[model samples]
Target chain A: MRGVSLATPYLHIDLPQLRINVRRAADQAALVGVALRPHAKTHKSAEVARLQLAHGAVGLTVATVGEAEHFVRQGCRDVFIAFPVWVDEGRATRLRDLRDQADRLAIGVDSVESAGNAGRRLGHTGIEVLVEVDSGHHRTGVAPEQAGVVARAAQRAGLPVRGVFTFPGHGYGPGGSEAAAHDERTALETARDSIQQVGIEEPVLSGGSTPTLAASLTSRAATELRPGVYVFGDAQQWELGIFEPDDISLTVHATVVSHAGGRVVLDAGSKTLGADRAAYSSGYGRLLEHPEARIVTLSEHHAVVQMPGPRPALGSLVSVVPNHVCSAVNLADTFWVAEPGGLRAWPVGARGLHT
Target chain B: MRGVSLATPYLHIDLPQLRINVRRAADQAALVGVALRPHAKTHKSAEVARLQLAHGAVGLTVATVGEAEHFVRQGCRDVFIAFPVWVDEGRATRLRDLRDQADRLAIGVDSVESAGNAGRRLGHTGIEVLVEVDSGHHRTGVAPEQAGVVARAAQRAGLPVRGVFTFPGHGYGPGGSEAAAHDERTALETARDSIQQVGIEEPVLSGGSTPTLAASLTSRAATELRPGVYVFGDAQQWELGIFEPDDISLTVHATVVSHAGGRVVLDAGSKTLGADRAAYSSGYGRLLEHPEARIVTLSEHHAVVQMPGPRPALGSLVSVVPNHVCSAVNLADTFWVAEPGGLRAWPVGARGLHT
Candidate 1:
């Protein structure tokens, strides 16, 4: 992103790097012979989603109904809300609208009660259902053995059961990818068998996370993979040893606003860079210019960094890789991209779609 | 907010409580004989800023030029960018525009070099400067004794030195408010004397935080008080024992999406409620209804709560108090306010103005 030092505290996306990252993930999925359904929760941009589709993604996975609506409005035909949705009357209305807009719509469910409610509210919408398997993450999903219960519930409610899916969120830590991959395969296989007992054979077993995408390829149980954050590797990915620093496509462009000796303060802070420091993550963020520098303290609008060597002068521009790319992207309204011609802006279209 | 369960994960504001909170701070400032410049960084809403003005506020305080411009465009005459800004050419143009728009424009400066740079780029703008004094917080300010050095530098650069200010951010901790208040008074007094030594008498001494506002009233060194989060008491304020449960005016309206026994999950998480858990804060956030519940884990869009007793049924709406209200407010585009007649939507006017 040359000649892009015009502002501070703006999220900058290197277009060339972004394209390379997108293609690399698609190539990995292709090599493994898994159908890639890239999750849009990380970038949340129509431009990025279109790139994923162009690179041979089967569909898009989203975390919320609002996000599904956003991508559908942007002309994405096949969309899956990858969250265990609690469909109330309001969500039923919105999901019905999304069903009419998209060629294919799917949602995750972990319990019989919620599946029954979704079936009651949206039976005519013909939205496909995917039973969420815990897969050792134990977050908003049923145990692998209980997947058939929710699948039968969906089927009884006239909602067609498509497959089973899991997040494998445990993959995002130190020495976690290998074990998480093993757990994902075992859980998906068990869920598929349980679902098959209920007469749904050859179920689409979807499993993948950025940290365990390649490791998960060891098993052939997963027919589809949904990996977010692969489009823009972040500081956590670097610290977890899952990604090279060269793979980070997005960074916060900040200016050194204050400093005392080797202590530097950047204009970018929690408000811009996001405040998500995982237990295994090294720090709040990392400076691309000074790899040894540590962002010691982060408040609303100030990121304090301790540099080992000479610090940058006040007003000197720096790029920061956020610890969690998804949360950081959610904080922004626009993405500043370095195009071949010049700096351009793309809307973070689904940024605040909290519902 | 009554009859406002149309959606989940939306921020809800109790209009009556918000008014009460605003008037309470105004009354405290009046009784303390200090000019109250309510920081708009908390709400970032033009309607809330107007309410603060109606409660006898002197002006509005912001953290960025974009924020200052937002308030100014909303018809606020006087605004203070209460951050040690490092002005580059782009920021210089923006600050100059702000000076032309605002009736009274002031910014913070912490270093002589930045003061000179601002002077070079915006000398003729007639913008006032406040020398930032480092209280016990030590985040981003010069030492109390160095206040005069920066003040003199601002004067040399043709920028009018308007006085000194300190954040006292350390006040937001358990049993830390009292000592932080004492430190704030001492820092302001030492800074006032230091600025006086630089030939600026009757400098505007400003120091205050939500936790230290009442305690700092014991000292007469401060001529102005700035408290941002008092308008919407949050989990942090409650944990610090600075606010009563009744003082909380805002909450996230979420739904019980999933549950297994007492292990319930809400459809709100870090993306909506924010991920700002301080060392002294209890959990990721607090549920208004289930006060004893522990939010065990938080993901992008799921808050896992381990409740003690009988839990709310599936699809039941719940209220969640965010750890930090400012960050939560920033994550939303619209504020659902319970007006007397009905619910109303107020734009989070300055949302995502990162630059």
Candidate 2:
């Protein structure tokens, strides 16, 4: 009832809290002597990226060429596509266009095949290639020992070898950040030593997540940190103790559409909250105010909430913190940003352009 | 490799199959001697709704007031908000505005509280109200015996009571459609008899799902049928024997962005297929061509698909049939309709305008 003007069940970001989150991350990274290259994949907004840059982020990190292109159009000069670059004839053209706009473009290479593809496509564009090493997240990236071989292959293919990077995604589990960051430091150091053993001067050693960044401060192996979700801490981060409740910035503002027999239905459904409940999650997500209420089920337009006490009256407004902020941001076209009392709309300029 | 377009990974509906699906549902409803009020919440496309009307659908069924308003603005005359309507002072004004535009506006009421709320807010507008009975889908609605009490309450508040309606949502489970339809018949008959016993004539009795419509043909209690997801049969319906592989009208067209060690990564992530995997589901969804491949995990912009044999090369195209089409449609802003031999684009006018 606090002047809820959202098209019921839309995401709302408190700008005041978001700014504080960004500044905190920047301040922490600066104190640790690591360049904060905030991953724009979390917010996927040029406005948020500008804020991160304004708060002292050195550059931006993205997952796709499309995302890099979007931020480049918004005047971002340096970007690193952190995922392994698998180039075909079509994507190579897009990469060429991206290189023309940005001052520096760094791509990740995990295997010799991808290195050859990048080199063949890049020609003489002088694209900087980073050998992706498998830290603990076994999803992508190469083994540390193999990083030097891929880097040598990339150099042979006419691409400039930059350094090595890894994502400590396994750090998200309960009490795993410290161990995972330790593993990250070992992987980065091993990969860097391998590259150096091959006599290639690798400069950037990048690694970090919201969970592992704090633990990464004592390590000298990583020179740059890329933490995306820290700017808008989510339910998972809160549960992992990576963030406190007050650190959460973005929330989905929903209206109570139905109430019957201790059950409340919110207008925000899977479309707003997203359906990314991790295996460790107790429920779909957590409600901000109604902590006792559990989001039992979600359809396309209706979120069935199970309340512990009497049901909320119809038309009551509530805020939901999603299990994963990245997926939630991808579901909406735009989100509202408020500075405590003054809320302004920020279009998610690159919400669904997921190429 | 097929000519893979560089579009983002997500769901894409084949226009030709969509047309065939629309015609089949309309034809089946006509044969059953019941009006086909095709639910537009599945596709959420005004163009699809127009095709449904052209194919003999009498009206449209929407899950939200925002959806109903979207269709009405696109020239739909009769619309029914099939979900339980809960009115407060603020929503009452919007409901009145909706009543002013359409030839007939109908809402569902499942409880005495909702009936009172509707009556207090909508009495002057003369909007028709339908009592929602349980009919074995225990998600929402009231018991059949309670229909009379709700109807009497509506009448006392000076609101017009139309009839009764129920959704056989249990039909979605394995071999549950036949039993669910039988339950639907009993509930509709009981509600109708109870309403008439109260000295008021019940004009309508509506119930149906794609799986139960054939079984419901023998029931004279139901005056109309509302089936939405049949327009775009999904993997769930395919497994339930409700639709053949050929009957699947929508598919997510995705490009292989990465291939390594017999693993392929798709561009279509949870944002496209949606995170609606039922407990019985093997994976996030099913691939139409590569049936052996399983979508093991989905990040925001990437889907890790594990193939049984050697992986498809990067840039290869694949089509996937999502488990639930409704949530997939909600994630997209617009969809391309590729006719059998022609091409056209249709805006999903009500993609994210959920209130």
Instruction: Give model 1's DockQ, 2 decimals.
Output: 0.64
lDDT by residue (tens digit), candidate 1, B1-355: 3433467889999999999999988987788688999889999999999999998999999999999989999999999899988887778888898888889999999999989988998776789999998898878889999999999999999999989999999887789999999999999999998999999989999899999988877675689999999999999998888888788999999988887433699999899988888988778999888889777789999999987778889988889999999999999999998877777999999998867
lDDT of 2: 0.82
Clashing residue pairs for model 1: none
- Could you tell me the lDDT of residue B264 within candidate 1? 90
Best by lDDT: 1
lDDT of 2 by residue, A47-143 (tens): 9999999988888999888888999999999999988766766678888988988899989887888888889889579678898888977667788
| Candidate 1 displacement at residue A322 in angstroms | 0.5
Stretches > 4 Å off in candidate 1: A1-5, B1-5, B260-262
Best by DockQ: 1
lDDT of 2 at B204: 85
Model 2: residues >4 Å from true position, as ranges?
A: A1-7, A197-199, A340-342, B1-4, B88-90, B198-200, B217-221, B340-343
